[model samples]
Target chain A: MPDDNNPIPHWQRQDLPPMLSRRFEFETYSETRRFLDGVAELAEAAQHYPNLSFGKTYVSVTLDADGKKVGPDLVALAQQIDSLVAGTP
Target chain B: MPDDNNPIPHWQRQDLPPMLSRRFEFETYSETRRFLDGVAELAEAAQHYPNLSFGKTYVSVTLDADGKKVGPDLVALAQQIDSLVAGTP
Candidate 1:
């Protein structure tokens, strides 16, 4: 888990809806599928789900704080998922 | 399956990226999850994948024709998924 104080820099912060969003590129569909599987696992464990959308070679993610202003916890979870995605082959 | 010539009206069409995108709103996390499950099944059946993202009460979807111009096939798939999502409780 990443420190809540320091959010991942790669994720673009958005305020229109108070969320953090990013798109992860992949080399193949299989790789993208694996990354999504990791995200599913993370969602199940944390009970904090992010909107995850993927194409043949990319996965786009958006994290919202469930009606609250986007907070550190959401950022940290995004960072955690980023790590999980990076860890995927 | 819907007619290939006619697509769903609610889905907004975009040409910059050659894709069709829509966001579906739900009343609960469980509803969102169920909608996602239906989407997964649709993906498996069509062998066509869409970028699908969901927050606590909404699911956003984008469908691309896999490097080709957004065609009837992609639009049809989106329409198909739209029906599946609408069917979810």
Candidate 2:
């Protein structure tokens, strides 16, 4: 998990953006869309959308502050998405 | 609307690929994500997902048969997405 006081862990950092990024794999398009649905819900509720790219079996989600300083809400959003994928929330 | 027997209409054809592509604009991130949620549902129900790209105020959806011959499902999926955006269903 990522928090404000420490450097984001490698497992959590996308390391390529001023944003948090991650890729998720699915067994089928249906499964992938299910996950994307969760992301869409999370983003809408928070009013903080991510850049989403997806295909038959994979999804790549990228969230950037668009040149602003990264904030806790973004980190929390990433965690929420991860939890959604894990099926625990 | 795109169909099986005719060239896809200019109003409907994305014009850039062996795929159908289009961009949607939103007034806010929340609105964009709401649209994306609809797309996710449509894709999941049909088992055909689009390549989705989005940001704060815009979304771009691209769908390809992925080198397979374009089929009715693909065309139908695109229309459903459009209608979903239009809030008709």
Candidate 3:
């Protein structure tokens, strides 16, 4: 068994793309809204939208399918949106 | 930036906790049912159970809130039962 102290590290945002489902954490409401807008654009293009739940400072999204690849693709899109938010673009 | 070929690793079953929400995948219907049973026991005990969606061979659960600690504590309990299934007990 993995040791408790040695508990595995959470999958970083970069690693989250390929999950079966995803939940994103953000720093503020505008950030959260902006991320959703980016995802909305992708959804409009690919027609592969996800289920969304918005919180005060977070947004949780789950895909319609459980395929391994679906999670990460959506995560990647979200990360792209995040980069747009971070002024790294 | 990370490479696409070297995509970040998916959060292992072990590292999934401490997340605000969680989703679990299993190998078989029996296995999925069994895991849900274990979670049920914990829910009965803690009264902090989650929302559940039982698929053919997978079960997805999402928490009511987006708190970090809740994700991992529950994941830890699920791991205990997973170890039991793996003959590690």
Candidate 4:
């Protein structure tokens, strides 16, 4: 059964040399689609992409490279995504 | 510092809705290179690639998708790579 949070079901994490992975999500289909495009742009710009898999109601990404800006990309988006999924932010 | 096993240095683990990560390593330049190409092929075939970073002496991969086969690709290569790195296989 797929839900809004676990888009990449049957996924497993691996220690990527020096990289870590965090999953992100959104509330609605529109929000999820927006996030997909925005993140794809960011990854293309930074030359860093994640293990991305999406559904109509949800989206997720797993980090696997040298995340360039922890402060700007990872920290900001993680918090934002967390809030959306949890209904707090 | 950077050894063979921990290639992607600043990595952290996140709860991927339903994902887990395990690291794999290899020894020697040629061996590492072979493993890289082979794994890349598997990723391409399975449509599931790992977070890859390389060095002169080692290679590593992090899983982030529904691993095609716990019995075939993932299991076979993971064990082979590990044995090569640990000097046991």
Q: DockQ of every model listed?
A: 0.60, 0.57, 0.03, 0.03
Q: Mind giving the per-residue lDDT tens digits that candidate 4 earns over A43-69?
A: 555555454545434455666546343
Model 1: colliding residue pairs: A51-B54, A53-B52, A54-B51
CAPRI docking class of candidate 4: incorrect
Candidate 4, residue A5: how far the Cα is off, in Å? 26
Residue pair clashes in candidate 2 = none
Of the candidates shown, which would achieve the greatest lDDT relative to the real structure?
Answer: 1
Ranked by TM-score from best down, the candidates are 1, 2, 3, 4
Residue A39, candidate 3: Cα error in Å is 1.0
lDDT of 4 at A13: 34
Query: Model 2: what TM-score for its first chain?
Result: 0.77
Which 10-residue window of candidate 1 chain B scores lowest in summed lDDT? B1-10
Question: Could you tell me the interface RMSD of model 2?
Answer: 1.7
Error of 3 at A15 (Å): 18
Full-model lDDT for every candidate: 0.77, 0.73, 0.50, 0.47
TM-score of 4: 0.31
Candidate 1 wrong stretches, greater than 4 Å: A1-19, A65-72, A86-89, B1-7, B14-18, B65-71, B86-89
| Model 3: native contacts recovered, as a fraction | 0.00
Which candidate model has the greater lDDT, 1 or 3?
1
Candidate 2's C-alpha runs over 4 A off are A1-17, A28-31, A44-46, A71-73, A86-89, B1-17, B28-34, B44-46, B69-73, B85-89
Residues B27-84 of candidate 3 have per-residue lDDT tens digits of 7655755775675566556555455555435556554433444455555545543444
* CA deviation > 4 Å runs, candidate 4: A1-17, A66-88, B1-89
Which stretches of model 3 miss by more than 4 angstroms?
A: A1-19, A66-89, B1-89
